[model samples]
Target: MTTVTAPPPPAARTATPAPLVSVRGLQVAYGDGPLVLDGVDLDLFPGETVALLGSSGSGKSTLMKSLTGFAPITGGSAQVAGHDVGTLRRGRLRNLRADVGQVFQQFNLVGRLSVLTNVLTGALHGAGPVNAVGGFSSADRQRAMALLDRVGIAHKAKDQARTLSGGQQQRVAIARALMQRPRLILADEPVASLDPTMSHQVLDLLQEIARADGIPVLVSLHVLHLALDHSDRVVGLRHGEVLVSSPTAELDAERLAVVYDVSDADQEADDAGH
Candidate 1:
């Protein structure tokens, strides 16, 4: 026997990298209302796409907002890109937002602007007043075009953003996110407005971006199959708590259904009311 032991398994691969986003015991509420997120813990490492799965009102969007300092952190802590989101000052919060790229269900583009200009607007994040007045620089224009090309829409760059189809507009939105050079990407039901085919395409592009750029992508999705197909890991939320967290490889529709399971008390209430 050689007894080589496979070179000590390559030193255990140097341990996994530190998470770009870490949330511990996170809790959120809205102006004395009920808790939206309770004791939620999450971690997002570089180059990974983590799907956030939940039904309506499951705190999925609130969790994303917590990471960006948009939600009220009633308790616990959330750290994104090394900034403590719950305690960040105004300027630092702006920096944190700048470092994050956000995609929404409705493509939030200036309809009147050209596709190229819409993409370039992403660079305005954390910019000074002068940059806004002077307009985007030539370098910015070049980079915006390059990003549009990368998203497979260079030819449409000159057209008004609203002129593109849903899928094409979503692509432009993604390119705009890329224009931010984000350290992390947060997509809140990004594919909710698209057809199944376009949903697949946009999710595929987001995963590719996460891997290629080594950035963490946290995407909230209502569709089970899409999450199963696209993510490296899955975090399932239910009634403001994490009900399931596991590698996507080990998850299926049956396993993930727990996230959406109705509680006995609620079911009893429904039955009684009926």
Candidate 2:
């Protein structure tokens, strides 16, 4: 009789909660140009605020665009909310884009529109276009007001978006992103134009939203102290690659210096994308 041996039981593995956004060995380039991002790996989990830190040209913006299907992924795999972004069809790509909420540095709200109407535009993400902004349903109007209130700007709902302060306008932009009822949020330098006080407030609100709603928030930042103070985690990029990824408590300005090729971490810009 041949000797037979039973295989040993498999090793017990630690349980890790699935990430809302997951990327592995990601690479991005444009039309034969050199890679903008190279071999990046990242994850954004629920109920966390992750800041992206890097100098300009460090692939911050490009990383973000990849998640929405705007940046071309030349290699690796990106799975977002269960969708394989690299191989998605156009229709699926549209659906993928609809699920992610975006906030910009310039506060991309319609200057001529009422703040309430601007917030309602977010509801159009998954829903098809309507006859007009004025034609939004009363239910949506109520939800818009609720989002504005959540962002602490419900009183400005009737005012034109351009009439608000820079900080308040940024708040409106944030409320608009919230109105989407998004599964994930990408804030690309959302507080760059605001005063220091407003920046803190906005960051605080984002953190609260992540906790209350159990969603991940990925914010790109240019200021170092803000990233340290505002985010629960930090992801530092250097020349299109992730140099450091750690809990905020474990990193300091000196620890992040290499990301900027500097003597200290007072410079730059996250969970990441693009």
Candidate 3:
């Protein structure tokens, strides 16, 4: 008779709560237009940087906008910072926005305002009678300064925002976002205007913030190399649909080719048809 061996037991699974941001079957359309985002799903966990990648018009920015209630979400569900984005009330919308930090490509700072002042504005969201001109609490100022320092722009606190270089401006914008004490961050093309060096610096800083603060960062990027180099995971979009979503370690440049393929094939078909 042949001998038989029993198999070992399977490992136990750990129980973790929901992610900082959860999205499912997300669909969006503007003014009766075609769906800009269709059947999308995403998750952003604590201490992770998730890069959003796509060609132009692929719905990359639209996805980011949906998280903050900027885009018109027609269907599906989205939750960010513990708020149900699709169902937020008029009053609750402000609260939701306050909890979400945002960074943008243009560094959306008041060019005439002092860097510190610009950073302080982040606290105004949902703030009730905080005296924007001359009445910020001492603790708020200290925190803003600390955030500026964290972004490596503390020494320029007194300088006008317009005087700063592109990298410095972006850094200041990041510091401003930090001032919000946000649970989740949505960075839409945060490094699009920066040079190669500045882009790397900004992305590295964002990644470090994500890990250190235990916050989830969802940053949109056009450059494939930057996404691969900086993110813990990547979500690729093609013509408003998700083409690839996976951990960075499990992916490479070739694997992300799907983001460009849909548009490329359409162009090819047009040529062939002609």
What lDDT score belongs to each candidate, Candidate 1 first?
0.89, 0.87, 0.88
Model 1 agreement with the true structure over 1-274: per-residue lDDT tens digits? 6775555444545688999998999989899789989999999999999999988889999999988988889999998998999888898999999999999999899999899999988988945785677488888899999999998999998899999999999899999998889999999999998987899999999999999999999999877888888999999999999999999999877777778856533432332233
For candidate 2, give the lDDT. Answer: 0.87
* Candidate 2 residue 16 C-alpha distance from true site, Å: 3.8
Give RMSD (Å) of candidate 1 vs. truth. Answer: 5.2
Model 3: runs farther than 4 Å from truth? 1-14, 132-134, 261-274
RMSD of each: 5.2, 6.4, 5.6
Q: How far does residue 148 in candidate 1 sit from its true spot (Å)?
A: 0.4
- Per-residue CA lDDT of candidate 3, range 130-248, in tens? 45455677888999999999999999999999999999999999999988889988899998898888889999999999999999999998677788889999999988999999998
Which order, best to worst by TM-score? 1, 3, 2
The 10 consecutive residues of candidate 1 with the worst lDDT sum are: 265-274
TM-score of each: 0.91, 0.89, 0.89
Mark the regions of model 2 whose C-alpha exceeds 4 Å error after superposition: 1-15, 128-134, 263-274
Candidate closest to the true structure, highest lDDT: 1
Please report how far candidate 1 places residue 254 from its true position, in Å: 0.7
